[model samples]
Each structure stands twice: as C-alpha cells, then as structure tokens.
Target chain A: MTAPARTTSAAMLDEIRFDAAGLVPVIAQQHDSGEILMMAWMNRDAVAETLATGRVCYWSRSRAALWRKGETSSQVQRLIELRLDCDGDTLLALVDQTGVACHTGRRSCFFRAARDGDWQVIAAVETPPDELYGDR
Target chain B: MTAPARTTSAAMLDEIRFDAAGLVPVIAQQHDSGEILMMAWMNRDAVAETLATGRVCYWSRSRAALWRKGETSSQVQRLIELRLDCDGDTLLALVDQTGVACHTGRRSCFFRAARDGDWQVIAAVETPPDELYGDR
Candidate 1:
C-alpha cells in the first residue's frame, strides 16, 4: 500500500521540525506484528533517502554521516510505510525487518522492560551479532 | 500490577542516555487500548517527577520548564508504567489518560493516517479545544 496523496518532497520536508542538530527522532516498527523495533535519528538527507529509496536510512551521530540499516549486519529493513506524527517532530516507519534490529541481534532494540523499579531483559537475542556482522 | 523487583531512582536515571540537551524522547500510550496518545520530551527532572508522582510531566522546549500534562486543559495522563528502550535513548510511558491528550482536544495526537500516498485523518476531536481550553 502507498500513501493516499503524493505530496511534494519540499512540502513534506517543510512539515518536519528538525532539532538544532538538524535531526529528528524516528521509531522503527515491525509492520506485520506492530512491535517497535528500534528508535533512531534522521537528518533531512536521511529522510529524503528513505522516502526516495524505500529503504530505512538513518543519520549516525557518531559517524557524522548517513547510515543505512542492515548495511553492515545484513539485517535490512524494507519500508512498508512511513508515518509522521501530528506535530511532525517524530516519525514512525513500519518496516519488514530481516534477521534482527538490534546490534545485540535481538528482534528489537527495545528488548528490556522497566518493571518493579528495575530493568529486566524481556527478550533474548535471536541472532548473535557475531553471526550477523560476520567479522567486521 | 507491580514490578517483580524494586529499584532506586538514581539507578534508573543512570541507565538512561539523555541527549546532548539533556532531554529524551518519550511516547505516551493508552495503557488499556495500546493506542498512542502523544509524543513529548523529558528532562531528568521530568523523568523523576513522573516516577515520583505517577503523573506524566514533560519538558517544554519553548517554555523551557517542566510541563505537567493536562495542567491547562485537564487532559491528565496518569502513569501506568515507565519503560526504557535498550539503548536508553527512548522512553515509553503507558498511561491512564483522563481526557483528550492532544492540545486540539483529540483523543490522540496521532489522529491522522498516511494512506495511498495521502494523509487521511482517521479520528476526530473527542472534545472541542474551545471547550477544553476555554478561551485560554
């Protein structure tokens, strides 16, 4: 399924309120299961890239550059839908995630739960990062 | 329900990874319905306030101070639980919302649906903003 309206990229970009660091927070969710996979930051270019390519791309603060999800680990996320919150400061990307979404090789990055005043590991790693990354 | 184990505020706070601005992105969801109500930012103090008081509080980037949800519009969100994502950059707040959670008096701030390339409003205002805010 596609968006109902085909708006100009400029107009869509204009709606977003990027922070002083020129980044916006985005949540990646499993399209089929409605499970939240991870949260990351995206710059204008990363946003443009994901919309244009249908692949989830993010702005790596540490790398100071565009980072493509699953590029290194091969756990790619195929974009099924991209949604912007009402205020446009946040985004939710529904994706068909492959393998795992966490560096720890878990199904989701939110694999821990805060309960009883402590953090508990709710889910275990589905695939080890060693296997997903395979040497570098 | 209560957590299996109890922890301290300092321990919980230390696990969080606040951004350079000392803020974290928070998503408030309806505890029973699983519907997302709104997104907000929180500083360390706001985090403590919500946990200590069981009332959701956020940081107003514009006002540069603590903002208690529903303080003005009476759309209070009582904290059901607090969760931190694995990396600790994002927070999920399951809440018992008393009224509409949007400033526009909608049940949820995410009232729009992006479909078929267009933005379609899926939900309507539960209470009109005029009545909720009342000339404020």
Candidate 2:
C-alpha cells in the first residue's frame, strides 16, 4: 500500500494547536507492520524539522533540546508519513524504524502489559541496551 | 468474555514511572469495539482514583486538578482493563465508553486524516460540541 504524502511545513504546522508548552504528543508507529513503537513530545521546531528532513525529531523534556531520533543510538525512525489527530492536538508518525525504537533496545517502548496485577514483558529487546545507546 | 481484573491501586501505582511533571499519558480505547477514543494525562492520584472507582479519571493540565470523567459532559469512560507500557511511562485504558469521547462529540479525538497534502475530517461528530459541554 502506498503511504500518504506529507503536507508542507506551513500548512502542517498551522494545523497543530500546540499546548501552552508549545508541545504535542507524538506516537511513532511502524509503517508496514502497524505496530506502535513509542510516544514522545515534539515541539513546533521538532515537527518542522521532521517534515523537512524525513528524520523524526522530538523534544526531550529532560534535555530540553531537539532530539534527532537515533542521534546517539542507531534506532533511527525515518518518517514515512505524518498525521494530525482531529483536534490537532496529537501527532501520529508512520516511520521506517531502524534496529530498535526503545532505549532498552526493545522493538517498542510498549512491550509490557499489566496482567493479573503484575507487570509482564510481552516483547523482548532486539538489541542490548548497551550496544544501542553506546555510552550516550 | 469477562474483563481482566484490575490490580490493587498500591501495586499498580508503584509500577508507573511518572515523568518529572508527575504525569503519564493515558490512551483510552473502546473495550469491545477496539476503537481508539482519546488520550489524556493522569497523575498518581487520578490513577488511584480511577482504579478504585472503576471510573476513568484524569488530570486536567489546564485546570491542574482532578478531572472526573463525565463530570459535566456525560462522556464517562468506565475502566475495563488498564495496561502499563513496557517502560512504565504510558498507560492504556480499555474502557466502556458512554456517549462521545471527543470534546467535539466525535466518537474519537482522532478523526482527522492528512490526505493529499490537506487535512480532512474523516469522522463525523456524533453529537454537537455545544450540547456536550453545555454551560460549562
């Protein structure tokens, strides 16, 4: 199936009704498999950069800077398509994910489930955390 | 099929790794229909209250207070099951939703699609926005 093309930065950014913090919640999903990989915060600048470069960029609330996905880790997310939810409050990013999307080297950040009152890992790490981050 | 039982509030809350803002993003999905409804923020207290009462409660970022689901709009979301993501940074609430979930009275907040480089409303509002938030 062919992916939908992204809109111009001007039109796309205008559609987003950013919060007072100038941020929106973004969900990264694997394009072909329909697997949700991770959720992160994205500021206006990050969203613009992602559209311009096709590399998913996020705002690290902790670091307070533009986070180019896989800048340090090799689990890059190549933007295939970008979507804005109806209210224009959240973003859905379809991407061609590299090795892994989780900091833990797992395929996704949503690998755990609260089952029977206990947390269980439903998915395993594709690469070791140490190798993916590599001291950063 | 019966719903999965919820864990004790004490045990479940301990598993959430709230961000520096003491907030976690919660995704509400229609239990039987599997329809993604809306996403909201939740604090520890809201999480505990929701679990204890079986009413999906959330923290209003704008109001900075507890937001009881359907407090005014009659769009209550009753908890069916709650899942904690692998990183413990996000939560998924399988809920039995009553009435509309979006402020716009659409069945979901994700009603927009970025089609052909333009934004389009993919889903129609089931109820008008005015009646949903009446006098509030």
Candidate 3:
C-alpha cells in the first residue's frame, strides 16, 4: 500500500490568510518552558515547510531565504501550535526551542534595557557577532 | 547645580519613526539568560514610559492601554536594552523577565511542535484560561 499524500499549502491556506506581501506574522515561544521567543514573518512556503517538518521555518525578508530557526546554531524550534488572529492576517506559533534564538548569539534578539528614560544596554549572554559573523 | 533632565520624546522621536498607525514593533528578550522573550507593539508614550521606569511597557492593540509586561502575573520584564532597526521603524528590547510570558502559563507562548506535515502538541506549561484567567 502507498503512503498518503502530505498536506499541501492549498489545504492549509484556508486557515491562514497572508497579507498583501504574502507574509504572515509568526510568534515564537519556548516549548517546554512556554516563554515567547520572538516574532517574525513567514511566506506561504515557509509555513508549508514548517508544517511539513517539525522544524520552524520562516521567510527572511533580509536574506530572502527559507529560514529554518536554529539552522545555524542547531537550536531548532519544534512547532507546537499555529494560531490565527481574529483578522486572520497574523499567526502565533508555539514551539520547543533548543538554544539561543537571536543571531547575535544571545538567547533572543532582544537585549536592551530601558531605564531613566533612556535605552541602556543591560544584559547579554552569547558573545557579540564580531567573531561569530566575522566583522560585520 | 541641578541634575540634567532625562531625554524627552522630542529628542527620542528624532530617532524613531513610527508607522502610519503610530505604532512601533518592540522585541522582548530575556535578561539574565539572554533568550528571546517576545515581540509586541508600542506607541510613543509607551516607549517613553518603558524608558522612564525600567519596566517593559507596550501598547495593547486589543485594550488600547499601556501594558506593563507581567503586571497582572508578577512576571515582570525589566528593561535591559532597546535597539533600533536601520529604518528606525522597529524597536528591539532586551529585558529581564520574571515568570512565564504566555497567557497559558508557560515560560514562553510557543509550545507546539510541527512534524511530518502536521502540527503536534509537544509541551504545555501554563494552565488553561479557565483556570488561570478565570472565565474572562
């Protein structure tokens, strides 16, 4: 007997409504701990690929590639839930994460602290990208 | 001699460019561990308050009020870092978080796992709304 066909974009598209830019907002969260990680945009293919595989996939507006979260750091995000807002233009993805989520090598891209009406640098975990990304 | 006054919106506004809606995207991250926490929207005042108090403040689109992260739950987000995108339309905030970031009671909002063309429920930390939020 042959295996069943995989779920395609056409099937999932009914529930997901993309914006005019063909992008849907994706909210990332930790799996076991249940903390929100970050939010980004994903195109149809990115969503489809994420569902097709356990890995969280995003459309990188900057690089224009299918960004599999943690592909570089091996801190892959395993999808848990994909929710749509009332407008159907946004998505909330619950995921299990492995390592630092930010490219800066920090657990997240957010790293600034606001104090005394000024945005100040407070905490950082991983080393800055001068060494990781190699000089800008 | 008097101490210097804190930076005002007039000065900070010079650096930030809000979208037509007068809302800017704010990214949240963990403080001590350096993990990406979450992303939300903020208006001009919310930005000012976050800086003034060292607490993470956001503009709630649903309620239209200034939301202090972890206000209700005591899982506060202490401001650590605030960054600006090249265009100055987006804001990145690094914060020190106290508790779970998700309404569901998880450390993060993300908890679903996607695998084999389907979204699978992997981990759940927070209790359901019926228990946590208490029936709206």
What TM-scores does chain A show, candidate by candidate in order? 0.91, 0.91, 0.79
Residue B94 CA error for candidate 2 (Å)? 3.4
- List the pairs of residues colliding in candidate 2: none
- A118 Cα displacement, candidate 1 (Å): 2.2
Q: Best-fitting candidate, measured by TM-score?
A: 1
Residue B32 error for model 3, in Å?
A: 2.8
Candidate 2 RMSD to the real structure: 4.5
lDDT of 1 by residue, B1-136 (tens): 1232234368888899998899998988788776667789999988888887788899998899999998888888888878788779899888899988888778877665545545567788789999988986
Kindly list the per-residue Cα lDDT of model 2 for residues A16-41, writing each as its tens digit: 98988899998787888766688899
TM-score-based ranking, best first?
A: 1, 2, 3
User: Which digits, one per residue and each the tens of the lDDT, describe model 3 over residues B13-121?
Assistant: 5567786789987756575564544557899988877766777789998898989876666778876666754345667676777766767676654344334444444
Clashes of each: 13, 0, 37
Report the error of model 3 at residue A121, Å.
Answer: 9.7
Fnat, 2 decimals, each candidate: 0.43, 0.46, 0.20
